[model samples]
Target: MTLPGITPYDGKTLPQSKAVSATNVHEARTALGNRLRELRQLAGQTGKQLAESLSWQPSKVSKIENGKQTPSAEDIKDWTRITNSTSQATALLASLRTLETQHAEWQRILKGGIRPRQNALAELDQKTRLFRVFEATVIPGLLQTSEYARARFAESIRVFKLANDINEAVEARLKRQDIFYRSDKRFHFVLTEAALRFRLCSPEVMLGQLDRLMSLSALPNVKLGIIGFETQYTASPWHGFWLYDDDKVLVETFSAGLNLAQPQEIALYATVFEELASVASYGRSARGIINRVIADLSPDDAEA
Candidate 1:
């Protein structure tokens, strides 16, 4: 599974398509601003008049209406009440929530620890019918063993200075793996050779994790592909991303998790996934790559 004329990854940061996340966020804000402006106009109030009624600066009203500023919950409530459109408050707040979800800072999201975040993702897992995952550095969560997941969670707690909920978070993540058994769902995972060789966990734990991957790959609904170091990739695996059906692309950065739902963003990720998958080894070839990594980890056993 190799393609000619495509450049291999040069171990540099490839230009990403994630800029669309910011664009979509701005567009959503502008639409929300337009709705608030319409409400004010229908109430026969000028921007100055409304700002005066709410005891806010006139420029504040203008900024919110032009999407230059985000309105707080209190601001939304006061604006709706003053405009005599309190009925729109609920809908408006829902839109605000959607905006907040698009770019969640890791600190704010993990304030309560990682268990809640795992539960939230579990809910999403329940709804997604097709999952297309590509990983460049570490194994995807669904296929990780409990020991490996614990190591990952412990690192998160240490980095974020978060409370030690490593045990609970590990349990929740393992529970999410239950979705792999569902016959109605489908999963396609592509991983770079680095994911298999990375020493994120101890050798014993990684050995167990590699065994888990070998078993999971045999599931009828699961298709696992590995891009070995020898293969030339058609697309540079800039970063890992999860595509949920055709609806959303979830990207985890160093500071924030970006939830991209714009059609173009989803399409771009889908195209990249296909290109990576094209050069990946599946079935026996994929197993051979995993076995080589496993043997490298346990040279004594290999010699025996």
Candidate 2:
């Protein structure tokens, strides 16, 4: 659903209502990366210098700063030593350990085995003022139907070797959709054309998913846009990212999710979102695309 500028937070509270929310592994990693970068800069250390001090390669420092790699606690301690901020380094090391504790593969949440992960997401869905989602390959979880979610989650479980709790996981996912219907919040989604047509489950299941997309696009508070595969974007084909207001960002990769908390990086993600929105189809044109996808599914219903 597309939420207009109107937010539950009054104009006065909008500034203060901004929050920092990292509901998953990707988000935490992003946040940690931002912190590391900030501490490095505050200490007036260059990436090359930091790497030399840490006895690691410069590329590794760059990857950590860009949220490309999940930094180990040892790496973080070294980063702090290079920056000459012993106290700050220790604090961040603790946070990183907390993030990595017990759960190593965050993708497991989708597959049905990570119950805590699923619940953490639900809790975030309860309070977020805005959800800015750009999906490169499939529907955002907030908008996914139970069938599609089950298929996606089940596949994740098998592929990742996570626990098989598809039934409970699917139920949690469906319940998570309540945020869309709530009058107090807003959800906006920017989907790649490939994602619009990506059939994760059966033809019937995809149809249901598309139909739901159409329905969600019509909501006054929901804004759904599709980026055609052929069209050029100002920020073309960036990795899938979910920006939750000014508080956090979830950057997805093949191996892990990066949670970003630093204000600068979150701002960067928001800027990218704006650029993506600028190039995407909206309103009537966007609705027409959704309708066309739905129409294409009608004939295949019998086959399913």
In lDDT terms, which candidate is top? 1
lDDT of each: 0.88, 0.74
Worst 10 residues of 1 by lDDT: 1-10
Candidate 2 global TM-score: 0.67
Tens digits of per-residue lDDT for model 1, 160-269: 99999888999999999999999999999999999999899999999999999999999999999999999987677888999999999998988889899877667767
Clashing pairs in 1: none
* lDDT, candidate 1, at 102: 85
Q: In model 2, what is the error at residue 83, expressed in angstroms?
A: 20
* Predicted candidate 2 versus true structure: per-residue lDDT over 128-152, tens digit per residue: 8898999888888888888898888
RMSD in Å for candidate 1, one decimal?
A: 6.8
C-alpha lDDT (0 to 100) for residue 292 of candidate 1: 96
Superposed Cα deviation of residue 108, candidate 1 (Å):
2.1
Work out the TM-score per prediction.
0.75, 0.67
Candidate 1 local distance difference test against the native: 0.88
